[model samples]
Target: MIRQATPADLQTLAQLHSQCFAESWSAQEFARLLAIPGTFALLADTDAGFVLVRVAADEAEILSVGVRPERRQQGLGRALMAAAAERAFGHGAQTLFLEVSANNAPARTLYGALGFAEAGRRKAYYNEGGRKADALTLKARLPLGKSA
Candidate 1:
């Protein structure tokens, strides 16, 4: 189920980020975003796993989306992404963007399949434990009506 995330979901979301990303945000930070106005957080939950997105203004970014490592390649990520896109469009978004580590092939492939194209790159965008990692900025135009 994809729904607006609440403060109660922070711990689970934080744990997932720790498991999925080399560098994770602090619990306080996650909670802060949830408390901020104009910030939208969505979570998809089930026995399988969970996926999350943070949308601000007309741009939506995938804050954290993960399936237990054992459940990888089972389509949970795609489902979460579809929900994110739908929600973004519903909330007046015209475009969506995300940053992925340059070496993350699976993520790049998934975004490509979702109509996200490589729009640009940020040099040394991430600090991995210590070393620097470049980030690829991917973008996709959300379905918008003539009025948008």
Candidate 2:
């Protein structure tokens, strides 16, 4: 089931992140983000997927989204994203943005499928071992009138 994430979910979120990223965020980092005024998170417990977002004014930024490697390709990422967007809109967000490593084809494809468009790019934004990867900025306009 998908649900809003509380501070108590930090360890599980961090564990899921570790399986998805080469450089995973720590539980302390997740705590700090969650403590921020506009930050929010959602989790799909059974699928081990989670999405973190920060909304301010009419804009929302996706901080991170991940599913355990073993649990990927099962639509968990999409479900988490849909939940996050709905929650952000309910919180007054009119648009959403996120940055993904250019090298991450699967994530980029998923975002594109969800109607996110490339907005910009950041050069050498991710440090992968001894290499650097570019980051792609993506944006999606929320259907404000349908928000609940």
lDDT of each: 0.72, 0.87
The number of the candidate with the highest lDDT is 2
CA lDDT for candidate 2: 0.87
Candidate 2 lDDT score at position 69: 80
Residues 1-148, model 1: lDDT tens digits: 6666677777777777677776776678788876765565565555344555566777777666666677679787777788777877787777887889887888888888888888899999888768888999888888622222
Candidate 2 structure quality by residue, lDDT tens digits, 21-121 = 87889999999999999998888967488999999999999999998888889999888888888888888999999999999989998988888888999
Model 1, CA-based lDDT: 0.72
lDDT, residue 39, candidate 1: 61
TM-score per candidate? 0.82, 0.91
Candidate 2 collision pairs: none
What's the distance in Å from true for residue 129, model 1? 5.1
Q: Each candidate: RMSD to true structure? A: 3.3, 2.7
Query: Best TM-score goes to which candidate?
Result: 2
